[model samples]
Target: MTEQGQSMLNRTVRKRHQLSAESIAKDLQISCGLQISITAVRRELHGMGLHKRAAACKPYITKCNAKRQMQ
Candidate 1:
């Protein structure tokens, strides 16, 4: 995995929080100088099992969004 990828995972664990793939990808590009897409970030997070967690307000929203976008 890329250093940025590792850092992303670490941040998620440290914060016990998850961010959207777009947010992570933007951070990687702007902060870490890594040019990657949200889709790539999503794939990486899936491989790491570190993707966004369910939210209290709309528990399945993220999953639904992912499915829609992928479709």
Candidate 2:
């Protein structure tokens, strides 16, 4: 990744920490028109001191669901 691309990736991760390599690659392609491989993205991220992390799965509780659970 170029310096600009790296900065873009850094900013992106800062804004949303839950992004995967595949999604980040796709976003770069769509937004920056940069055709990069998933492995390349991973390598660049690793070079930038970023690593893979699994997002925590949390169920969304609507008001109705919250009320039902409280019963």
Candidate 3:
């Protein structure tokens, strides 16, 4: 694992929440002098066990009429 690359990605991601793999690659190129591709960045992020996800708000279904269905 590239600690330097990962640190750079973490810092940039923390500062700019919308930064993606492509952005991270560019930032690393400009700041750390490392030439990287989006796919490589994405793979590294995955290897680090970081994934993108959204919170889901779901309603419960607990009012069904069981007796009525039996009839």
**Top TM-score prediction, candidate number:** 2
Reference-based lDDT, each prediction? 0.69, 0.84, 0.75
Residue-level lDDT tens digits of model 3 in 1-71: 37877788777777777547887888889987988888988887777666666659975544476555666
TM-score of each: 0.54, 0.66, 0.62
Q: Which stretches of candidate 3 lie over 4 Å from their true place?
A: 59-71
Give each prediction's root-mean-square deviation over alpha carbons: 12.2, 7.3, 4.4
State in Å the error of residue 56, model 1.
9.3
Model 3 vs. true fold: TM: 0.62
Model 1 is weakest, by summed lDDT over 10 consecutive residues, at 9-18
lDDT of 2 by residue, 1-71 (tens): 68888888887778777558999888888887889899988998899877777669999999999999999
Each prediction's number of clashing residue pairs? 0, 0, 0
Whose lDDT is greatest here? 2
Tens digits of per-residue lDDT, candidate 1, 1-71, equal 67756776557545645568777777667766777787877877787766566736855558779899899
Q: How far is candidate 3 from the true structure (C-alpha RMSD, Å)?
A: 4.4
Better model by TM-score, 1 or 2?
2
Report the alpha-carbon TM-score of model 2 versus the true structure. 0.66
